[model samples]
Target: MAVKTVKILTDDIDGTEADETVAFSLDGKDYEMELSSDNAAALRNVLAPYVEKARRVTQPARTSAKPASRGKSESGLDIPAVRAWARSNGWPNLSDRGRIPREIQEAYIAAGN
Candidate 1:
């Protein structure tokens, strides 16, 4: 039998919350999972740094709006709500230059336009 492998884009690179267990690719592609888990440690290894960065970006444990570790506000658009929104709507590609998340949230802050 062939070692099954899956082609997950890794949410961190795609800019979402932490790593998500992908049952299948977003485009509905089939995966030949090599490990018992859908996305294994080896797979996560390649994406660990990005995942850590994203994890720190939207730390669910955080409850207050504070400056990001990267030196920017934590989505001025209501941290918790924006975190949920980003998770739901897909964390869009924004500049990770500390300003990106805030910039993206600015739209939400100014919503109803």
Candidate 2:
């Protein structure tokens, strides 16, 4: 005997049939939601301004250990200090946790930290 399975996606907001799945990240966490085309378009339109101005953070390729360890072992720099400095220096989008971006790290080092 053979069996076939079907999966259906429902809009997270309006409870209608979803046309696609949208994936996004916020505050270092990733999320996915199914949405109809109209809702998806609306979401994109709402985020267009911020998205246009935002910097894209590409994660490094992973190995066996945690990604944060790579940043620490390579530089031996203080993460919290960098975060504090960034916040004080007008980097509003820097999150308190997770590996700091390489550009920020370079800036921190260049600033004599």
Candidate 3:
């Protein structure tokens, strides 16, 4: 299953702020994480590549016939690249699943990731 979105919940419980425990959802499954501010920054640093890659979609230069097979929507990105892009953007669970769904493929292609 391809992940649709990532939802992060950072509300403190019982009005206590002792090392926040953030709750987030990936593909509908919920998980919690507790980390220091430094760790959160580190995590954002780790995810920067994926986020940037998704934000910037450049069509590869082709000098010969038979360019990379574009998707139905013609996103110009191959399937592997799409999957990797998704995984890098907080879709780690996709590794266990085979063949990204049509909706996800469409979104990935549409987003030019």
The best candidate by TM-score is 2
Model 1 ranges with Cα > 4 A deviation:
1-76, 92-100
Per-residue lDDT tens digits of candidate 3, residues 19-105? 556554556588877655655566668777877776444568877775544442254447677787778776677753455767777
Put down candidate 2 lDDT per residue, 1-113, tens digits, no spaces.
Answer: 89999888999999999999999988889999999999999999999999999998888887896455633526798777888888887788998677788998888888999
Best by lDDT: 2
Q: RMSD, each candidate, Å?
A: 18.5, 12.4, 19.8
Better of 1 and 2 by lDDT: 2
TM-score of each: 0.23, 0.53, 0.28
Give candidate 2 misplaced runs (Cα > 4 Å).
64-113
- Which model is ahead, 1 or 3, in terms of lDDT? 3
**Per-candidate local distance difference test:** 0.49, 0.87, 0.61
Model 1 agreement with the true structure over 26-61: per-residue lDDT tens digits: 234655433433345657686778667752323258
Find the 10 residues in a row with the least total lDDT in model 1. Answer: 9-18
